[model samples]
Target: MAATAPSQSAPLAALSSTATELDVRDMVEALGAALTDAGIDGDLRGSITLAVSEALNNVTEHGYAGRAPGEVHMVVDLLADRVLVTLSDSGHGMPGGALPPGLLPDSSGARADLPEGGFGWFLIHKLCLDLSHTRHAGRNTLRMTFPRYLAPEKS
Candidate 1:
């Protein structure tokens, strides 16, 4: 039997998995495939993948305290003028004043400390058209968006 496409009106595709490094890679791959199928391309695909990976890694490393395994949920939505991705984790909330910086450097020169924790956040902000983070009901939700102009060209 052929696979069925998700409903257009639904506006989201979601999956939940235990917090694991391998699982995160798999999730990113799956999400990337879905986004590509939806016509997301150019730098947009790379941006989405990077942002999602960083967000998920944050959940595994900081949110879960790198000990107890928790659930990470990801949702992707296809809009007329943009693609939106939301990743949620059932782990500890972000620390006070732990938000990412507003500006990011275009070159590696701006990133002097490669071993630090700021690169992921910088990449997410630099790649996505918009990004938002929220903590609610004991979960952290990171939402990312890509504009239509950046989407992949249909074959």
Candidate 2:
């Protein structure tokens, strides 16, 4: 699906906080609530939550590496047919100052020897219909959109 802007006058949710695990969790929960309020449910909601969590976890782990955590912001907008999420932080830009290629990791080895991580960008790329990143003036911004897999609201 094409990345479309929200038709509504306001975003479904927005949050800002110091880049920390707890703060990330809270912000993601807030997004989940907003999605629920917008009548999104089932796997789409879970996919959005997971993608946002991975993005936020990246901020906590890599963005703030070797220094005090900085501020992070998340804005969620519900379009008629998709959801847009923008996450920004005043920390390190992506390695090499660009978004990763998001190549899937090698998983052909033994289960015990598989990589413990390195799937964040890959999953984000897979889940989002569109994704982009930018770095300017000591800040990084990631924008992504996911198709609304919309399930009917249960009575």
Candidate 3:
């Protein structure tokens, strides 16, 4: 299935959910709202959302492709000066069992070369302050952090 930005789900402030197309959107939105409600700035929320969306999208479109069912778990933790998002899935792990090094998208690529859609990981790498990936016991886990002060407060 093609990927599109997901709609907001009911306010759940979710800690975890099954990683399915039917539940991904709601989980993302609820998490986003929870962050903002906790006093994190909107810019940070957007970056986190973009990164999380990309991660969840990958889990859906790549890991669980062919509509195969699996568990994709998300856990958000708020620290004193930063937020942590940990995502886990029992589907296929990232190619080579680790994140590629310095894989930020090349913006200089020509228009035709840009037709392929893989900007998600690039944004995740660029936006996230800290990113860690590990595959253990058939579960692939990603942990990313964004400092609370990185995003400026809204006017």
The candidate that wins on lDDT is 2
RMSD, each candidate, Å?
5.7, 5.8, 9.7
Which portions of model 1 miss their true places by more than 4 Å? 1-8, 102-117, 151-155
lDDT of 1 at 8: 44
Which candidate wins on TM-score?
A: 2
Q: Each prediction's TM-score against the native?
A: 0.78, 0.88, 0.79
Question: After superposing candidate 3, which stretches have Cα over 4 Å from the reference?
Answer: 1-14, 102-110, 152-155
Please rank every candidate by lDDT, starting with the best.
Answer: 2, 1, 3
Number of the candidate with higher TM-score, 1 or 3 = 3
Candidate 2 clashes between residue pairs 3 or more apart in a chain or in different chains: none
Candidate 3 residue lDDT tens string, 1-155: 55533332232244566677668888888877888787764688888887888888888878877666677878777665777788888888787877866465666878777636667777778778889999899888899787766862222
Candidate 3 vs. true structure, TM-score: 0.79
Model 2 misplaced regions, further than 4 Å: 1-8, 150-155
Writing each residue's lDDT as its tens digit, candidate 1 over 1-155 gives: 56646444665567788888889888998888887787776577777787788888888778889568889988888877878888888788778835667354445555574444457777777677777889888878888887755643222
Clashing pairs in 1: 41-152
In model 1, how large is the Cα lDDT of residue 85?
85
Candidate 3 residue 63 Cα shift, in angstroms, is 1.4
Pick by lDDT: 1 or 2, better one: 2
